[model samples]
Target: MKRTGKRIISMLLCVLLASALSTTALAAEDGKVLKLAFTDSPTLVIGDMTIYHPSYAAMLAFKGAFEKSTGGEYSVELYPNGVLGDAASTMEQMLTGTITGSTPADGALSAFAPDIQVFTIPYLFDNPTIAYDVLDGDFGRQLFEKIAAETGFRVVASYDNGGYRNFTNSKREIRTAADMEGLNIRVQDSPVYLEMVEALGASATPVAFLELYSALQTGVVDGQENSCVTTLGASLDEVQPYCTLDGHLLGLAFLVISDTWYQGLDADTQAKVDEAGREATIAARGICRYAEALAVDTMVANGVQVYSPTAEELETF
Candidate 1:
C-alpha cells in the first residue's frame, strides 16, 4: 500500500510540473518583445523634414508607454536602417512573425493591395492638408482596415514623404511633356511608376536608391523623379543641375505591425503603441517639410537653378 501511494504521489507531481512548464511556455509566447525593422534610417528626408524613417523610433515610445500602461508586462525591440533587408522583405518578416513591425509607403503596399494604387495616381492630391484629410479621415481608415483584412498588417500611423517632382542633368529645362521625349530617367521598380514615367514620354530605368549616385555619375540615366528633400538629401542635385517642381504625386508612409503580434498585446498596451506612432509621425512629417524647404533654399543658394512648371504645362501628364 505504501509503495502504491508513493507511486501515485510521484505521478501527480509529474503532472503538476508538466502543467507549470506549459504555462510558462504560453506566457513567454504571449509577451515576447516585439521586433521591428525598417529600410530607412532616422535622418532620411521625404519632404520638408527628416522623419524618424524607421518604425523603431515610434515603437520605442510605444514600448515605454505600453510597459507603464501594462505595469511592466510587455516590451519591444527595434532594428532600424535596413537591418532586415528592404522594406518589402521586412514586411514579409513581419507577416511570418520573424519581425513584428515595419514602415512602408503606399508604393510599397501596392504589391499586396492594388487598390492602394489609387493614392499613387499622379497629381491626385493638390496639397498636404487635403491628402491628410483624405487618409486620416474616413477613407484612409477604411482602406487601412480593408488592407488589414486582406493582408495581416495593421496601420498605426500615417506620414507624408513628399510631393513627387523631377530633376534632370540636361541644360534644356523640362517645361512640358514634350521636353521629356527620349530622356532616360530613373524610377522605382513599380508598374504604376513605369506608367507615370511612360506618360511623361521618358524611358524609365528602375534603379535602387543606393545605386542611383553611380548610375548618374556614369550617365546611366539623364535624371530621375523624386521629391525636393530626396533630390538634395541624396545629393542628386550635384549631378543633376535642373529641378522641375511639377508636384506630380505625393507620398505617404504607414507604420504597420503584424496583426498576430498586435493581437497578442493587451488592449491598453496596444492603445499606447498607436498613440506613440501618431506622435512620432507628427515629428517626422515636421522634419521632412522643414528639410525639403531647407534643401531647396540651400541648393538654390549653391547655384542650382529651380523652376516650377507653368500652369498650362502641368496638365500634359
Candidate 2:
C-alpha cells in the first residue's frame, strides 16, 4: 500500500510539471515580434523648444496602439537615436527583413524609391493642409502601392518631418536668396539638396545629420537648412544664430516596413498594423505642427535672430 501511494504521488508531480511546460510553450508561441527603428533623440528641451521628437514619439504610439489593438497577438520593439543604425542603414535592414520597420526621411528613402525624391523639390506643397490632403488621400495610397511593387517594402504612413525647411546660419541673417551667396551651407548627401543649395548661391556641402552640430560649431559649414523643430531638437539654434523663414521645402518622412513580413501576417493582423500606422502618423504630425508653431518664439528667446521675408523679398530668390 505504501509503495502504491508513493507511485501515485510521483505521477501527479509529473503531470503538473508537464502542464506547466505546455503553458510556457503556448505563451511563447502566442505573440509575434515587430521591431522598428529610427534616428532621433527621444526627448529634448532647450529654452521653450521642448520636443518629444516625432520620430521617437510616433514609434511609441505605434507600439502602444498595436499591442493593445492586437490583444497581445503582436509585440512592438523600438530602437531610437540610431540605436539600430542611421536612417540609411535602418532602411536597408527593413528591406532585408533584419528589422520589421523604420521611419526614414524621404531623402534617405529616395535611394530605394527614386520617385519619392519628388518631395525634395523646393516649394512642392503650398501649405501643410494641402500636403496632408495629398498624402493622406488616394494619391498617397497609390504611391505606396507602387513603391511596394517596386521595392518589396511597404510604406505604412507619412509623417511631417518637422514642418518646412528654413535656412539658418552662423553668419548674417538670410532674408533673401542673395543673402545665401558665399555661405558654405550643409545639406543632406543628396544630389537634389546639393543642387538646390548651389542654385541659391551657397556652396553646398553634404554632411551626415549626426555630425552636423560639431561641423557647424567648428566652422566646417557656415549654415544648414532644416525645419525649426529639427534645428532646435539638435540644438543647432545655439550654433546658428540667424534664421531665414524661407519655407523652401515641406519636410516629409515615411514609416516603412518589410512587405514580406507584412504579407506573411494574417489579414486581421495586417489590418491592425495599418491602423497602428495611421495612429502613429497622426501623433507625429501633431507633434511637428505644435513644435513649429512655437519654434520662432522659442528661438528668439534663446538669442537667435529670425527673419521672415516679405513677398517682394522672397521673390528675389
Q: In model 2, where do residues sit more than 4 Å from their true spots?
A: 1-31, 48-50, 207-221
lDDT (tens digit, per residue) of candidate 1 on 69-168? 6544455566777878898898888888888778787778777777777887888877777887887799988988888888998887776764455556
Q: Over the full model, what C-alpha lDDT does candidate 2 score relative to the true structure?
A: 0.85
lDDT of 2 by residue, 1-317 (tens): 99999999999999999976675455447536788998877875745445787777788888999989976556687888889999889888887778889988887787799988766788677678888898889888898889988997788778878789999999898888898989999998777789989999999999999999999999999999998877987899989999998888997887888898888988988999899889888888898787787877788888899998998888876
Clashes of each: 11, 0
Give all candidate RMSDs, comma-separated. 10.2, 6.6
- TM-score for candidate 2: 0.83
Total colliding residue pairs, candidate 1: 11
- lDDT for every model? 0.74, 0.85
Candidate 1 has an lDDT of: 0.74
Q: Candidate 1 deviates by what RMSD? A: 10.2
